[model samples]
Target: MTNPLLYWLWLAERPGCSAKLAHRLLHAFGSPEAIWRADREQLAAADSLSRAKLDALADKDLTYARRIADDCARLHIDIVTADAEQYPRQLLDLSDAPLVLYVRGTLPDFEEQLTISVVGTRRATPYGLRAARYFAGNLAQRGCIIVSGMARGIDGEAHRAALEAGNVTVAVLGCGVDVCYPWQHEQLMQRIIRQGAVISEYPPGTEPAARHFPARNRIITGLSRGTLVVEAPKKSGAMISADLALEQGRDVFAVPGDINRPNSAGCNACIREGGAALVQTPGDILACYAHPRQPGAPRARKPDVRQEEQLHLDSPEVFAAAPRTMRTLEGGEPERTVWQAVHSGRHTVDEIVNETALPASDVLTALTILEVGGYVLRVGEGFCAADDVQLPQQTNEEPNLG
Candidate 1:
């Protein structure tokens, strides 16, 4: 019961301590008391840890661990360990899942026949905003729990739409349940907690760091049945969720963007890669929900192990201090690559990642921005292409991501 406190304490005192290592120690030794009771030889011999790891958990760290456990008992924040039934089965597919989930609200129903993640850039344009609201409204009307980051632009629009539509929604957060990041979304997050829920694995009082977002995206997709991208740039975190969704055997959908606009690139490229489904309306997503979604389905045969282990910039410095770059500002990838090959032309997400070798999460965001900006467009399941020079539409409202 107090292991959460012990683990948090162990982590705070020992910087560079691995969540994976901490999780395993608690699992194997039964409790912090047992772990502290074990001699250096026993802790060092563990397959889960290196000698460096063993040394970091010195006697002083153990005392702090006990204190943390006591604090958890006092606060009553629910601690979900890996073995717990509430650990969220979807995250188990990840190569490195969070060891514990410090949850404040009720966990959404994974057994829901329809669970869809709607994600996009925080600085989305007008088109991105309309698309998010339209898609969220469409899906919510059909009884799907809308999942998203309570970010600005598309994510904010999605939550609002879900609330307006009078349906449940879930906001997967990058910080602790007690702390609200970005400040602007505080009101929306409170609303989300009242209806669907607000969830995070980060411990209480943990600051919302840049590195936490990409990792947060994993849990967003992991908790849902599928993910939909309304907008994103090449380097946006929204794409990270899409990539993870594809790997988890969850369907991915994207709203196309203008080729001239940068924000839609990550989403556009995802469609091109066959890693996601092309969606233009809520029906496109609703169609998948129409057929009974098989929750807890087994994964496909093993693909590239590294393919799934895509990098998400975990450095605190990256999140805390890195200035927004051109790629982040531009946001979209080219869409003409869909027919070229899985990794084919016009700066497709997979190809861009192959060429520039940027992380998948980074590349995916670019595609999203492109889609929302109308730079690229999704055609069908995880497929995207540049707008084939069609006559421009002057429509103000969104067409909906079906």
Candidate 2:
């Protein structure tokens, strides 16, 4: 008996066979097996199979497919065909969806879950990293599956955040699932495989290449209902993902960043050109979906409409004017003191620790909470209070630092 996957693997590995052409053939022939059985006359009847593609499809050599299947079996990897029951239904919506997916872990029911793709530059800033963690972690906590490329900087941070939140997160790779592209993320890849999935269209043993990434970006966005860009330069892969998300009819959300920063240029441009929604918090993303939550699941927080309207265009002055509220100010002891220190012009972490006389660890934790809550923004090596955040009156009683 012929293995059904052999046909898919053969079709997927065929030269000059673009995803569009493969999809067209699938539409015409119904299945990979049927397409395999198609004769020259039948292949000619298909819509857009060029002579070269037809010839490539006609070769039908199973050598590579058999080797890949053997490798996957040995490595415990699963080959998910486009027609498989576990294949992401979201990817099927794309005109150029992959015919075969190499999966290293379990796949979630994508149709029943809210999946968001978080993408940004590999050279991410402190602010961008914090924003990525804040949004990705919160979204995961709220039952949204986090998806990213698992590259360094923002992508790595996003994946880490989701994993730290103890939720499922998917990493779509440019290389094969068996091969970790950035050697640094080998550990992260393993963790994702244990908790979620690391998936790729390329067969096992395929090495990373420059050309594979842009094509990889499509799958990253294709698997999600929305894509969140934390920070990206004018011409970056994150920008490409944002554009692909729009083209795929998925919502694109961008975290607003300083207009002067080159890393922020793409996100700012997306908002300015009305290509993406300006995201201030995870709530802004959840608000867009507004789907019913699972029993006992956290309710999606609605975004502040007035504030969103003011900052819709992502104007620098508007952002500076509409400072985020220090919501956690009244919640804790050291946080209030840390906020007071930053508010009183104590910039760096050391300065805040010295001023508050709190342990560096405590001060750092408080500052992180403050920053992620939008009460403060990291500027260079130091931090500053958000502009226009009304400061509370000084209290005679000191915070309970003990």
Most lDDT-accurate candidate: 2
Tens-digit lDDT track for model 2 on 1-402? 999999999989889888998888888989988888988778988765678878888887789999999999999999999988999998998999999999998998888789999999876765677788888987898789999999877898899999999999999999988898677678889999999999999999999999999999999999998899999998999999999998887789998998777989999999899888887777678766665556565323345565445433322332233444444344377888888787666767877888999999999898888888777777544676664354556689988999
Residue 20, candidate 2: Cα error in Å is 0.8
- State TM-scores per candidate: 0.66, 0.74
How close to the true structure is residue 359 of candidate 1, measured as C-alpha lDDT? 72
Report the C-alpha lDDT of model 1 over 73-133, residue by residue, as the tens digit: 6666676766678777777766566766776566666674477889997656546666787
Superposed Cα deviation of residue 237, candidate 2 (Å)? 0.4
List ranges where model 2 is wrong by over 4 Å. Answer: 292-402
Which structure among the candidates has the greatest TM-score?
Answer: 2
